[model samples]
Target: MKKLLVIGLLTLFITPFAHAQFGVKGGLNVAELTGRDGESASYKAFYHVGVFYQAHLLGPLSIQPEVQYSLQGGNLKSAFTNYDSQLHYLTVPILAKLTVGPVFVEGGPQFGVLLNADQSGNMQVGLAEDGTPAYGNVSRPATGSFKRGDFSLVGGAGLKLASNFSLGARLVAGLNDINDVQNLSGINDPRLQNRVYQVYAAFQFGGGK
Candidate 1:
């Protein structure tokens, strides 16, 4: 029943795009977490692959919607300890695009559904409180109940390299918090939200022109 509902919704949403050009896109993702109270972290390398439809609505104006599987997460080094957190998401991004000659610019909102979350590190022992240990023991392969849904804003530009191939880059920033209680220990630590930079190439199905 759930599968049927999703298929129905996708069909409805993609009907308009069916009349336009379709393509496959894959990209590299540099992701990290940011918020008001999270630990210091570094960007982790990930990737996204998906299909998109570009429907031209007017002169030099079009609407593009994409469905992709994205891997997003970060690594943390706090208090001489290291942690790695990784997340998998199914994302849908809708963009309003403007094209001139061989260049195009687009911006829109991206919605994501979390498929998986994982953490590996020496962080289970918790952080120091007043220079004292907080957790009692070290746990391996720690788990957290993170949020399932994510919302973000994305803006990007692309250059046509040929009749059928294009290169692009995009910036994606989270609009909502993606934190869990299990990851927080004190009142001073901040939350976690996603920030990613993407670089990709697209291959059009019908000559990509």
Candidate 2:
């Protein structure tokens, strides 16, 4: 069912290609993990790059669908260790846009497939002879414990400076728990979700009026 939905959306996005405007976008992402038990998480800065197609539906309204490759995740400090998790995803967002003058607002549903997940950090190994704590770098694959799919909502507002240039900011909030770890002890675990803030610039090519 989910796979079918994804395929349908992809088909819809490309079906109007000849009449749509093509654009490229790249941005910075401030990402973090939400709903962690008692542990606090910090934001991790990452980036996203994508291409999109926009088609006018009516006066002041348009549909924009995008394909993006994003790097996300968060940082955590637990006990004597610091951890940074890197999550790589391929995402699709189907947005409905409203334009007024040079300003526009958009909101949409986004679907993502996780490509990889990894954690790299430093852990306190022992105490030095001088009584200072010693640390060692550690790295591990985290993909096995996380869900393969991510569902989210995207919302933003932006300004079009010209026919081919624009700037925007967006917020993407995860709509589903992305943790897939199994607890054999029958204890409920905290749900993990993705949260991100983005600022980007877009450049468009000729298409619609």
Candidate 3:
């Protein structure tokens, strides 16, 4: 169903703007979490790489479609626990771009399919008499606990750089819950949505009609 939607929309957007340009990009990702209760997850380091198409819809406006492999996650620390989880995703974004010569701004919706999720950290049950975690290390497998699909709103602006090379940045905020973690075992929470700030550079190769 989602796949069909993606294909159908891409065709609709691409067909009208047949004179599109193809490009490749890669960049840094600063990611964090929001919405979950009691979770003070901080921004973590990650990366994203992808390819995109820019189709001119009008004189100064265009429609862009992108496919990306994004590595996104967060760093979480509590009094008795600390860990970092790495999430891998295949993301597709369809953006409406407004261009003014060398400068442009684009905003759109993105859909992500989860590829994998892994966690590395230490967990503890209770503090020792000295006020330290009794069980120092615990492994939490984030698999099967997180949703397989994610949805986000993305917006950004950039320099077109002579129509060949470009530099840009964007923010992506999760609209759907990535993880609804709650347990009778005092385990998880529902506010594990993804938030990422991405800065990238792209090189244009092929020009479309």
Candidate 4:
């Protein structure tokens, strides 16, 4: 299975370079966390930057594979505290695109390797000696709090505004639980999965229809 997986990845990377349009992409990400039982975390804003190679397959069909750096997470708010979880990932998305005139729609699977994670905020730690509650600013490494691998599905549409530039929007839904820590000091949630919406611009180096 490992050998097959490596071979597949190699094919996806190598097949596009022969006759493909290379581009750079950057985007705004609105990310959140969702639970298995319908609970949700507050939305947090983040960003992603990447490069892609789009290989024309058929008349109006193309395959695009991208490598990107993405920051994704969610916010948890209480009466006295606001905790934000920041997750950094190296992500790859393999997409199949269909173009109709100036509009195009794409959908595919995305795999992410977690680079690191951290949480920052002011939250309640414990009670003070005088029978009063105490709060402190917390900033610490949280890489152990999440799973190392993230698998997701992405779908979106865009317009070919010009030959070299395009605008697009996409939705990403996590397929696995990312939370590795069950109960933490500030927040305790069930089955954390990523939910993100992205709006981006793609700049293709060699322009074409």
TM-score of each: 0.81, 0.81, 0.82, 0.81
Name the lDDT value of residue 99 in candidate 3: 84
Q: How far is candidate 1 from the true structure (C-alpha RMSD, Å)?
A: 7.2
Give the winner by lDDT: 1 or 2. 2
User: What TM-score does prediction 4 earn?
Assistant: 0.81
Better of 3 and 4 by lDDT: 4
lDDT for each residue of candidate 2 in 127-163, tens digit (9 for 90 to 100): 6898676768888888976799999999999999998
Instruction: Single out the weakest 10-residue window by summed lDDT for candidate 1.
Output: 135-144
Candidate 4 residue lDDT tens string, 1-209? 99999999998777645568999999999998777332336999999999998998777889999999999998866666777889999999999999899899999999999999989987666778985668788998889989999999999999999988999999999999898975444345547888999999999997576
lDDT of 2: 0.86
Between candidates 2 and 4, name the one with more favorable TM-score. Answer: 4
Question: lDDT score of model 4?
Answer: 0.87
RMSD (Cα, Å) for all candidates, in order, is 7.2, 8.1, 6.9, 6.4
- Measured with C-alpha atoms, the lDDT of residue 79 in candidate 4 is 66
The numbered model that scores best in lDDT is: 4
Model 2 poorest 10 in a row by lDDT = 181-190
C-alpha lDDT of all candidate models, in order? 0.81, 0.86, 0.82, 0.87
